[model samples]
Target chain A: MPEQLADTVDPANWTCPAPLRDQPVVVMGHGGGGALSAELMEQVFAPAYGNAVLTGLADSAVLELGSARLAFSTDSYVVRPLFFPGGSLGDLAVNGTVNDLAMSGATPAYLSAAFILEEGVELTVVDRIARAMGAAAEAAGVTVATGDTKVVETGHGDGVYVTTAGVGLVPDGVDIRPQRARPGDAVIVSGPIGLHGVAIMSVREGLEFGVEVSSDTAPLADLVAAVLAVTPDVHVLRDPTRGGLAASLNEIARASGTGVRLRERAIPVPDAVANACGFLGLDPLYVANEGRLVAFVPPAAAEEILAAMRAHPQGGGAALIGECVAEHPGMVVVSTGLGGTRVVDLPLGEQLPRIC
Target chain B: MPEQLADTVDPANWTCPAPLRDQPVVVMGHGGGGALSAELMEQVFAPAYGNAVLTGLADSAVLELGSARLAFSTDSYVVRPLFFPGGSLGDLAVNGTVNDLAMSGATPAYLSAAFILEEGVELTVVDRIARAMGAAAEAAGVTVATGDTKVVETGHGDGVYVTTAGVGLVPDGVDIRPQRARPGDAVIVSGPIGLHGVAIMSVREGLEFGVEVSSDTAPLADLVAAVLAVTPDVHVLRDPTRGGLAASLNEIARASGTGVRLRERAIPVPDAVANACGFLGLDPLYVANEGRLVAFVPPAAAEEILAAMRAHPQGGGAALIGECVAEHPGMVVVSTGLGGTRVVDLPLGEQLPRIC
Candidate 1:
C-alpha cells in the first residue's frame, strides 16, 4: 500500500497556526503529558536529529551492537489527571519505562521510576500509585527494580510527575534505527493515531463526541516483538505518539536523510476520528498515538511485516501509507486525493493541551 | 573515624507512631517527591518487606550474582527544583544512578536517564537539561546510551522530572547489603547531611538564610571505589537522602533484621544546617542528603575504610557516628549528649517539602 513519490510539489501549503517564534512561554496544558507536549516535541525539538538512539521513543534505548551487552533509554511522562481514565500516575510510570525498553527492539527487563509529587497530596494516592505501578510492572513482564520520590510544595507542582528509566536485553543482529530508512522502504503504521490524546482531551474539555476515543496508552512490547520476528530488516521503527504522524515522518526523514512521500488515499483514518477532526478543524496527522508505531521496511518484505503487525491485538488497524524516496532529502511530502501536494510539517505550538 | 556502638536500648519501653488509617486521596506536596513521600514509603510500603531486591536502594540492582557478577539493588529519586543548588535535574538523574551502582560495591559502568516533561515547557530548558545530562555523564565517566521523552500537558506536571537506571561491575570478594551488619560493626558517615534538603527548602520558601546552603550533590563513584579498595567486607553502604540518617538506619535494621545504636553527640551536623533545622522545627537526623553516605564496616577494618572515605573530595567531613548491635533487632536507638535515650523513628510526614 506504500504510495509512489509525487511528481511535483503542490502549491496549497497548510501553515501551522502558531509558529514556534510566536510563543515565548509554556502553558499549563503543555505539561499535561498529552497532545500539547507532543506538538512541542514534533515542531521545535525533533528537527535537529542525528543519533539513531534518539529516534526510538523508548523509555530506555538499547545500544552497542557487538560483544557489548547493554541497553539504555530515558523517558519522562507528564500525564495530567495524575489519576486518570484507566490508570494512575504509577501505572503510566511503569508502563512508560517498559514500553521505552520494548521500542528499542529489546526485551524490557528492568525499570527505575522517580516520582515528583506536590505537597499536601494525599498518602492514599501514593499507595494507589504504588499499587498501579506494581500491577503495570507485572503486566509488562518487568520489575520495578529501583525508584526515587521527591515532594514539592503545592503550586510549584501538579499532582504528580513520574519519570521512568528502563533497561533491557537486545538479542544480537537486531538493528532498528531511524537513519536506516532507504528509498523503496515501505511505511506501515501499527494502529490508529491520536486516540490517547483525543481521549484525554475529551475528558478534560468535558465534550462528549458521539463516538468514544480512549487513550491508546497500552504498552507496545508484544507488537514490537512480533514485527521484529517477521522481519528483522525493519529499517526504522517509531511510535507516532507526540506530534503524531507529521512529527514522526519529519523525524524519520531527517534521521534517514531522505524524503518520504505519503499518499492520502492509502492512509487509513477512522470515520469517527476523521469526522471529529473535520468538526474541530484539527488535523489528525498532528495528533498523538501512544500505542501505535510507524515502521519502514523493504518493499518485498513489507507485506510479511504488515501481516505480522496485524496479527497482534494492538495492531488491528495496521496499514501502509507511504514509501521512502530519494528526492527532497529530509522532507515529508504527501499527495492529497484531490491531486494536490502538501508538505506535512512538524507540529507547531500546543494542540489540545493535556491530551495524554 | 568509625564510631563504637553506644549501648542504650530498652526494648520494653519503646514507642511507635500511631498507625495511620485515613481516607485515600493525593495531596499536592506528595507529588513534590520530598520528605512526605518518603514517610509514605516507610510507613505503608517498606513494611511489605517481601524480598532483598525491594529492601536495597541501589540503581539497576544486580539480580543473579554468581562468581561472574555480584550485588543487586534499586533506587528512585524524586527531587524537586529539578534544577537546583549546585546541580540541575540532569546531574541528580545521572549521579543518582551511578551512586546506586557504587553502593553495591560495584564500579558503575553505565546509566540510563528518563525524563517526564510538562507540556509548554521551554525547549531551551530541555536542551539545557540535556546538556547538563551529557556533562554529568562525562563527570561520572559513564555514557547516556538511550533515552525517552514524553510530554504531558500543563497543570498535570512541573517543569520536568527525571528517572535514572544504572548497572555496575562488583569486584571480587565484595558483599554489601544491610543485613550483613554484625554486632561490633563500625558506622561511618561520608560527610555532612541535610545540605540538599535544606538548600531546596531555603529556595522554595524564599528564606534568605545568612549563609548559602547549596545542595551537596555529587557523584560518589570515586569515593565508593576508594572505600571498597580498602575493605570489600564493607557490611553496608547507604546514601542518607530523604528521611536522612534516621530512615537509612531504620532501613538497615529492617533489612539485616538487626539493631543499631548511635551517639547523637558523635554524629556530625554542620552548624548552619543545625541552626536551620532548629529554626524550622526539623531534625537533622530526618533531613535529606545528596552528597553523603553511611558505611558499616567490620570493627577491625573500620579505621581503614574511614581513612579511605576521608581521602575523597566528597568525604572531606567523614565521621563515625554509631555501630550495629545484637539486641533490639530492627531498631535504631540514639543516646543524646544529655544522657537521655530516644528511638530514632522513621519520619512521620513530609518535612521540608521539595527539599531534593
Candidate 2:
C-alpha cells in the first residue's frame, strides 16, 4: 500500500523460466533438485541469504573455521513405503547425508538426526527405524552424535520424516568442488546407476519384473578416500542423488563454464535397471542414485584414480562415462552406440519424487 | 516367522514407564520435550543407538575432533501459523538451533536448514520465511551454509516444516552440561518466561487478550558468550524451550543427582504472560520462552556472571531464581509466597503443542 514498498512487492521482477513465470505456488518439481530447484535457490534463497560460501551451490558447503576445513550438508528423506527392496528410509537418511559429505572429499565424522513422527504411529515402527539408523551410521563409520524428535498431530504428517545434517573434516591438500572442473578432465562414475530410483519405483507401483532391482544405497566415503589417497588433485566429485547424472553434469558444466561429452556404451546401467526404465518410459540417465558418485579428474591422474576406485567394493563397477570439453560450453552431449550424438539435458523435474 | 526372528520382533521388552505402558502409539506428549519425551528417548532411541555421547542427553553434544572442540545440536520447528506476533517460524528455526549450541557455551558458527514443504503452498510464503531466516542468521552472526528442500503430497503436510542443525566452536576450559550443577550452585534466568507459548496459543485460538503477547524468541549466543567471558567455569546453561523452565530444571536436578530450591518470587514472568497464563489456566513456569536462558553458576562466580548477563540486551531482566541443594536429591521444590513449599514436577506434556 505504501509507495516505497511497491517496488519490493513487484512480482514481475522475480527471475524464473518463462513456463514458471506465472506460477505462484510450489510444485513437486520445485523440490525435485533440478532446474526448478536451481531457480528457487538463485531467485529466492540466494538474494535473501547473500553469503559467498552458499553461492558456490555445491552439494555440501565447504567452509574454513579456525584453521579447520569442514564439509557440512543436510538432506531430508520423505520416501514413501519407509522400507523398500534393498534399504529403508532410516539407512537412506544416514547413508545419503554421509555420501553428500564424501562428495566433497571429506570424512564424515558426525551427524544430527531430527525426526517428525506423526501421532498414533506405532512405537515398534519407531524402534525399528531408529535401529536401522544406528546400523546405517555404523556401516558408514559416522556417528549420530546429537538429535531431536517431535510429533505432529495425526493427518498433518505421514508416518515419519527423517532429516539428517552431517559434519565432516576435509583433508588437507584436497580441493574438490563443482567449480573446479577443467576442460580436459575425465568424467567417471563410481558404480552402476539408476538402480536406486528403479527399486523405489518398483516397490511403489508393486510391479515385479521377474528380476528384483535392489537399491544401490551404500556409503561412498571409503571409495572417495581411496581415490584421494591416490591423488588429492581430484577436481570435482558429486553424488547424483535427486536429478541424477544428467543434472549433475549440467551443474558441473555450468559452474565450470565447460561442456561435457558422454559415451553411452561406457555408462554403467544394470540390465534390470535398464528394463525397468524402459517399462516405465523413463531414461536411466535422469533417475536418481543413492550410492554412486561422479568424479572429474585430470587426464594424468585419471587412470590411477579409476583403478583405486575399482579396487574398492563400492566402486567395483566403475566406468569412464564422459569428459569435459570446450566445444559446447555449458552443454552436455552423449554419443550413442549408433554413432549419433544426443544432447543430454537436465530433467526439469524428477520422474520419481521422494525416491531418496 | 522363524522362532528367532519372532523374539527380535517382540515389543514387550521396551523399557517404558508404567504410565506410558499403554501408549501403543505416539501421543502429542511424546514430543512435548517433557516426561513423555524423555521416556520416548530413553525407551526407543537410547537403546537403539547405544552410544555414550547420546547417553549424556545434553542439549548439544560437545565433540573433540582434530584440534577443535565443537558443539553440535539440532531441532525441528513445526510451529503452527508460520508467522507469530514477535517471531516467525523462519527466525525461530534459526534462533532455536543457535540457542541450542549456545547452551553448551559454544560460539555458534554454521547451520544447515532442511525444509519439508507441502505441495501448493504459495511461493511468496516460502520466500518470506526464507528472508526471515536470513535476517535471523545475520542477527545471530551465524551462516546458513547448506540446506535441503523436499515436498510432500498435499494433505500429508502442514504448509512447511523446518529443521536446522548447528555447529559451533566450544572454547577450552568451558565445561557446561546439565550434570555440572553443584550443590551450592546458584540458579539464574536470563529474562521473563511464558510469552512464547502464550503467543502461539493466542494466535491459534484467535483470542484478543487486550495486550498482544509477543514471543521472546531470540538468539542467546552473545549472552552466553558474555557469561563465559566473565567465567568459563559457569556450570550449566540451558535455553528453556518445549516444556519450558520446569522441564529444564527437572532435567538438571536429575542429571546432577541433587535437589533444587526455588524462590518463586524471584522468577521473572512478564505481567502480560502471567495474566495470559492465569486466564488460560496455565503455569507461567511451565510455558516456553525461546529467548531466555537458565544458568547454574558457582556461588562465588554467580554475581560476576549475573552482572555480565545483565549487561547484555537479551539478558537485561536477569534474575537470581534459586539454588541447588543437597537435600532430596533429584527433585525440585519452590518456596511459594503463601509460606508453603510446592514440588515442581516436569509436565507430562506441553499445554500447547507446536509452540516452537
Candidate 3:
C-alpha cells in the first residue's frame, strides 16, 4: 500500500489565491460533481433555492415534518454501458441512494428505483440488472421498496438509465451541515480519490494499462457511522463524486464561508491514477471518486476522528488532506508537489471520460 | 362532439385486427405511457420484481422507516423535443414528481432534481428550463430542495434528460394501494387520455389539425387531496402515463387479483384527441395522459369522489369509466363501441409519444 501523504507535506509551501466570484449558467463541469458543481450550487441554486433543508448540504437531506424526521435524497445514474468494471448500474443505483442517506446522518432504510430502459434491450441484460439490484439492496441492508419502469424506443433511450430515491431516519440531536465547518476544523478524506472515474474512463476509452483500476463503488454507512460515533462534531461530510476532491473542498469552503489550505504533498494519489491522468491531461483533483469522502471536523477531535475512520474497512486510507482557514474565505489553495503553489478553482467546462 | 361508438359495430366497420401480443421487446406503444407500458410492467417487471413496496402498486409508495412515515418515489421524463406546445421539461418534471407523491395520498413537500445535459446544449434552452422548473415548483407548492447537474458530450445525451424525486407526508390512517381494489368498486378517470402524447407527437411531426391538441401537464395534488378527504378508502390511484388508461386498468386488475369491466361509451376522450388518434391509427386507450388519473373507490363513495374530483381544475372532465368485477381475475375487458367485447390486456410494447 502507498504510504499516507497526509503527515509529510509542509504547510509553509502553500500559496493562497483570491476567491472565485463569477458564476455561469449550466456548464459541463457542473456535472463533474466537483468544484464546478459546488460553485453552481453556491452561486445559483443556493441563492435561488435557499432553505433550511437545502442549506444543510448533506449527502441526503434531513427533513423535519410534523413528528417525523426523515432523510430524503434522489440520484440519477446515467453511466454509459450500464455495466463496468467492479460494478453495474444496479450496484451504483442502490449504493448511491444509500450513501446519500448516510451523508445526512441517517441509516438508509428504503429505496425507490425508476428505470428508463431503451426499447429492444435484451431480457438477459435486464435480468442481470435485476439480480445486481437485489444483491446491492441486500448488501446495503435496504429494501428496493418501490419502483417505476418506462421503456423508450431504441434511439430515445440509452440501454438503461436508473434513478433512485431513498429515505431514512435521522437520529435526533445529530446536527450535520456543510455550513457548520469552523476555522479550526481539520479536513480528512475517507480514501484515495479518482478510482471510480479512472475505472470508467479506462473501459470507455479501452485504455490497456495494467494495474487494474476498478471503480471504488461501495457503501459508506459503516464508515460514516464509525466517524460520527467518535464525534458528531463531524460538521461537513461530502462524497467526492463526479468532480472529485477539488469540487468537494470548494463546496465546503463556500458553505462555511471560509477558505481551505491544503498540503499538496500530503494528498494521496494512486500511481496508476496519477499516470493515467498525466497522460490524458486530466487533473486528478477534479476527477470523480465513488467510494471516497471529505470530512471536516473540529480541530481538537481531528486525530480521534481520523483514527476511528481509519479503523473502518472502507476508510483504511483516511488522511488529513487540508485544514479550514480564516484568511481567504471560500477559496481552496494547494501547495504543489515541486514546492510551488496554485489556486484550485472550479473547472469551467466538460470533463468527459472522468466518471469511471 | 362526435357520437360515442356503439358496443357492437358492423363487421365491415372494423378497420384493423386486434394488436398482436407477441412482441419480444418494447415498441413505441410501451413508451406511450398507456396500456402497452402497463403490460410490460405486469408481464415482465412485476413477476421478476415481486416486492412488498412494489406489489402495493400505488402512485407513490408510503414507506415506514423507524418512526417516520414517508412517501418516496422517482420518475424519469424522456419526452422528446424537451419543450412542447403546452409545457416544457421543467414543468413536466415538477408535476410528474408532485403527482407521484399525490397518488400515494401524500402531500408533496420536497423534491430533488438531477439533470443530464448534452454538452452542446444552448445556454438559452437551459435558462428556459431552469425558469420553467422554478415556476413549476412554485405552482406545485413544492421546493426543488436538492439537485445534481451532469453534462455528457453532445452525441451521448439527448439535449437533456431530467429525473425528479419527491417526498411527501402520508396521513396516519390513509393506506391507498393498487391491490386494495375490491369488487363493487367504481373506476373514475380524472379527464381525457392521450392529450399529452398527442400534443408531443404533433410538435415532433409538425402536424397541424383544425383543433390543436396540447398536453394537460398539470399537477393533481388538489384533486388527490379532495378525493382522499371524502374517502380514504380510495383503493387504487394511478396516473395513466406511458401506457395510458388501458395499461393503468390492467395493472390494477392484476394487482387486485380481480377483473375490470369498462364501458367504451362512458370513457371520456376529447374530440380533438379522438381525431388525432384516428388519423394516427392509434387506440386512445393505449395513449398517455400526463395531467390525469384513474381512481378506484367503493361504489357508495363513487359519486361523491367524482364530484369532488370534478371540482378541481385538473379534474373538470372526471367521469366514471368502469367497475371492478368478480370474474376474469387478472384481466381487463372493455365493451367496444361496436357492441363487441375484447380483452384489454397490458400493452406488450411501447406506445410512442407519451408521458404520464
Pick the DockQ winner: 2
Model 2 Cα shift for residue A117 (angstroms):
0.8
Off by over 4 Å in 3: A1-27, A34-58, A153-157, A208-210, A278-283, A335-341, A349-351, A354-356, B1-50, B336-340, B354-356
Task: Rank by DockQ, highest first.
Answer: 2, 3, 1
Q: List, residue by residue over A1-356, the lDDT tens digit for candidate 2.
A: 01111222222232345666588888888888877787878888878776777768688988887778989999999998899988899999999999999999999999999999999999888888999999999999998999988899999899989999999999999999988988999999999999889889999999887799888999999999999998899999999988889889988988887889999999998999888877878888889999999999998888988899899999999999889998877777899999998777766667878887
DockQ: the better of candidates 1 and 2: 2
Candidate 2 Cα outliers beyond 4 Å, as residue runs: A1-17, B1-19
Query: Considering lDDT, which of the candidate structures 2 and 3 is the better prediction for this target?
Result: 2
lDDT of 3 by residue, A1-356 (tens): 00111323322232211222232234455565644455556554555554555656667777776676777788877787678888988788888878878877788888877777777777567667777887888887888876777666566566777778887787777777778887888989988878888888888888955687888898888788898888776788788776578767766776788889889877888898898888888888877777787888888899998899888889999899889899777777898888877777644433663252
Measured by TM-score, how close is model 2 to the native structure?
0.95
Each candidate's number of clashing pairs is 77, 0, 44
Error at A161, model 1, angstroms: 2.5
Tell me which of candidates 1 and 2 scores higher on TM-score.
2
> lDDT per prediction?
0.67, 0.87, 0.74
DockQ, candidate 2, comes to 0.69
Q: Is candidate 1 or candidate 3 better by DockQ?
A: 3
User: What TM-score does model 3 achieve against the real structure?
Assistant: 0.87
Query: lDDT by residue for model 2 over B62-105, one digit each (tens)?
Result: 99777899999999999999999999999899999999999999
